[model samples]
Target: MLIEVIIKQYLDEHLDAPSFFDYPDNPPRRFVLIDRTSGGESERLPNSTVALQSYGKSKYEAMVLNDDLKKVMRNMEELNEISKVSLNADYNFTDLERKQQRYQAVFDIYHY
Candidate 1:
């Protein structure tokens, strides 16, 4: 499937609370939020931040807040290293999916 389609589907399945992403008077904006751990022990985590990046026809923007910025940056750096190791890595789609899956699995295990 196309990366955009996968991303849209993943976003639909994940984000609990809605956050808007508007880019300079655009008619439509993407709504997104990170899927993170909830309750008790999870709340004590240092990496409790959501990172959202939106892309329009001509430009892209990123927003990161809370404790998540550090974790997200670290993960991005790790992915960059992984990309360097894997010459054929499709950083855009593949990396996003991988991260999403990783987090989803982590939440699943934590909740279970």
Candidate 2:
């Protein structure tokens, strides 16, 4: 559970923010950990738009040169899917990255 450990570490390190990580884009963003118990539900979290942004020649070229953003986004998506399945709940996910933002990050979560 490296991802869980990493998420816990990140949360422990950054308690000021509502969530652990934020993408550096136009809009301020965070992952909302959904609690699904007693038939109660929480808000859906935003999804990372890094993959969409990485499309096109220039951005693809840049991503090829440095895979940091892509890797981060992939990890985020994996975490989101895992959380969704683990919690057995639906999520309201959205991407916040704009066309102008070359770098992107996705955030999402679910809890049981």
Candidate 3:
């Protein structure tokens, strides 16, 4: 499976909130949006940097969702196609003008 599909499936099964590659037309107060920002292949191994944005009605809720994501994603090594998963960075990425509370977690995933 494609890495994005694999991640979406995993997150959907593990998390309580809805997740999508694009913002839903009628999104819930709490949700996750994922984007595969960059990728490359080296020595026959493919790797990608995926950014997962967790949104919530409040900053604390957003932080909690981000924590939950990291907790679950830590076990991605169990996936057969995935060789390694490392957190690149994470921080509050709230949109002040729009008044959306969100946190972004970036991960580097190496796979077959």
Instruction: Give a tens-digit lDDT track for model 3, residues 19-100.
Output: 9999888879999999999999989899999999999999999999999999988988898989999999999999686689
Misplaced by over 4 Å in model 1 are 18-30, 33-112
Model 1 per-residue lDDT tens digits across residues 19-54? 343323432232333333232334542222223432
Candidates 2 and 3 compared: the better one by TM-score is 3
Q: Each model's TM-score, in the order given?
A: 0.23, 0.22, 0.95
Model 2: weakest 10-residue lDDT segment is 47-56
List the candidate numbers ranked by TM-score, top first.
3, 1, 2
Q: TM-score for candidate 3, please give it.
A: 0.95
In model 2, where do residues sit more than 4 Å from their true spots? 1-67, 73-102
Q: How displaced is residue 73 in candidate 3, in Å? A: 0.7
TM-score of candidate 2 relative to the true fold: 0.22
lDDT of 2 by residue, 1-112 (tens): 3344444344434332233233334333322221212223356532211112222124443334224322333344344334432212222223334342132323343432
- Residue 68's C-alpha lDDT in candidate 3? 96
Better by lDDT, candidate 3 or 1: 3
lDDT of 2: 0.31
Best by lDDT: 3
